[model samples]
Target: MAEAGEGRYEIASVISRSFETVRSNLGLFAGLALILSGVPAFALNLWQTSFGVNLNAAQPDFSALLSAAYLGPLFVGWLVAMVTNAVLQASLTRATVTHLSGEKPVFAQCLTVGVSMILPMIGIGILLALGVGLAMLLLIVPGIILWLCWSVVVPVYVQEKVGVIEAFGRSMALTEGSRWRIFLTMLLVLVGLWLLSIPVGLLTVAVAATGSVIAVSLVTAIVSALGSMVMVTVQSCVYVELRNVKEGVAPADLEAIFA
Candidate 1:
């Protein structure tokens, strides 16, 4: 809703709407996030802590860290984390879209959609990670640019039911005229999250010092879940706003697609 020109969205509007969506659907978002992200994170943290690996120590025991026992669970945990995150993203997108359309988002429906889209979402996630990660290795600018372009790929895939490659193309097209604003929006959100994490990080360290790995991991998992909820909701909001600006598609129109 910027008057600057067609296909341009307001940064403040997107940010405000994103937070409002999360606030309004607090219970739903938190529940999905805890189930999808928090549990897995806690399990992974417990596994890591059990190894008694002091990664923070100077000249730590690389041999113990690189052993099969450590590396195997680490890989599996990472894989699970990735898949769960994809599901969470898809579910949150569904919920956010439904809410925007003035319909009450059903938790079961959102979760079903998320589960059904898991394979493609995972594929898209992998491709995005590889493409952006390689770009970052070459130059930071290109990575950031690619991230901005493909930021809404998951939502596009979820809503449009497109092939993985097509989702990337559609997202790039939707984000074409609004990358600058999108970049600023992302920067502000990230900065705010970083500032908020300061206290949470301190609390984490304090808990770790108490020799209570379970407590520390629980706190960490909760924080991660909340962070994921906010970020995923923001992504959904961005996708909704971009479609409105570029394609003139209203939330009601999108809602009917699911009907």
Candidate 2:
């Protein structure tokens, strides 16, 4: 296998290493996915499709749609899920970095690192969202371009410990000559996930037909969490490779950040 620090990496290696990392950390990652993503997804879906209905009516009560009681818990859950996902991302970044550096990762320590970094992550996310949203509004091509450029921002932020704004610049710097490669990798990952979801989609339909919203929601959440894990694993690998190429920073250096 080619070393990652050679300023070159095969897509196959990144994918293989990612799977290996996730498999090795499956227990912790699974718990993170379930609590941080799956539970919230299940809860929100169940509330909306099951407990949310007016018991006195055959259909949803249109008048009550805008009521505080209807939206409050759901919104709260959504916010919580958002925060939980950010923390999960940070935790995964830390886990991957440490593991690659030959250290055993602790879930609690990752969680703590995640919690500390949550606010900055949120700030960068909002900035990126607005940038992408505005570019998308203009024509859509620019948005895609921007998306590719910023694809590794979270990993950049988490790994570098730079300021939120600096992370954007750092990502752009690292991705300068490699945007096409990054875009193609992202495209492949998305297409692969979409293909995998076909069977999952059919299963969801079957579950929905059974008239059990909980079952359908559970399946959806699990699939979504799985997707999240795959995406983050790829991202963390990419970030490591990028740093190795651009700065000659080895995995051992990254491990020392947490040491």
Candidate 3:
């Protein structure tokens, strides 16, 4: 018991000290991922656009078909990213935390963090899907609201290792204190990311049939993936801070956890 208490103290202390490393590393990886994110999406969109050109040649209108086809896979991919992201980001945070304190954690450590959040991630996915479906039935407001409510679900699952139900509760709990801060930060980041992607995204159809499209798409996907990963990493850092607040560990306690 004494050793365990001491461990928690060490972990806490490390967390308190390693804050900056967490931000920098997470940023680097996430920027790369975000750039990659645009590829498959661009490919699909370009494909649809190409298909449109082939269909009737009269500026054929298949917008509805394209939405159903393109968005469905993209949505699924995004969910997978989000789920894995929670874990990876958590791992990243832990990694930096550990590194800052002169300890080592495996690259796979983030995978564990991501896996623990699977159930909650699935739940978040289901909710988002249902909401989107319902939105298709109704309008878009309710779905948007639900989406916002569950925004931090992955963070809940990864940080706490809670199951779906508990993750939901935890998401609500953690977000209470910092949800707005997080949300606002996310909004700004997303806007900035979008701005960054404007050139890449627009190139999709213009270079649609050429090898340039493929090359660009690949680059876009990798960057987007990295960006998503980094975003998750940052969120994970915030999550650990929240967890520490909840757990009431001392400075060194965190060190022990990483150790």
Best by TM-score: 1
Give candidate 2's total backbone clashes.
0
Which has the better lDDT: candidate 1, or candidate 2?
1
Local error of candidate 1 at 203, Å? 2.0
Candidate 3, TM-score vs. the true structure? 0.57
Per-model root-mean-square deviation over C-alphas: 2.0, 4.0, 8.0
Please identify which of the two predictions, 2 or 3, would achieve the higher TM-score against the true structure: 2
Residue-level error in angstroms, candidate 3, position 73: 9.4
Which whole-number lDDT from 0 to 100 does residue 233 have in model 2? 79
lDDT of 3 by residue, 1-259 (tens): 1223221223333233433554545553444334334444455544544443345556655675467666686677666555554444445555544544455545555446545555555566676577567875676766554554555565555434557777666766654544545455556656766887787677754554575645655655665565565455445445555456545643245566533
Stretches of candidate 1 off by over 4 Å are: 1-7
**CA lDDT of every candidate:** 0.89, 0.81, 0.52
The C-alpha TM-scores of every prediction are 0.95, 0.88, 0.57
TM-score of 1: 0.95
- Writing each residue's lDDT as its tens digit, candidate 2 over 1-259 gives 2335457645666677777888999998787777777888888877877755755677767766777888798789878887888888888888888888888889899888889988887777789889999999999899998987787899888877778888888888877666777777777888999999999999999988998877987998899888897898788887887777767887778767634
Model 1: clashing residue pairs?
none
Error of 1 at 55 (Å): 0.9
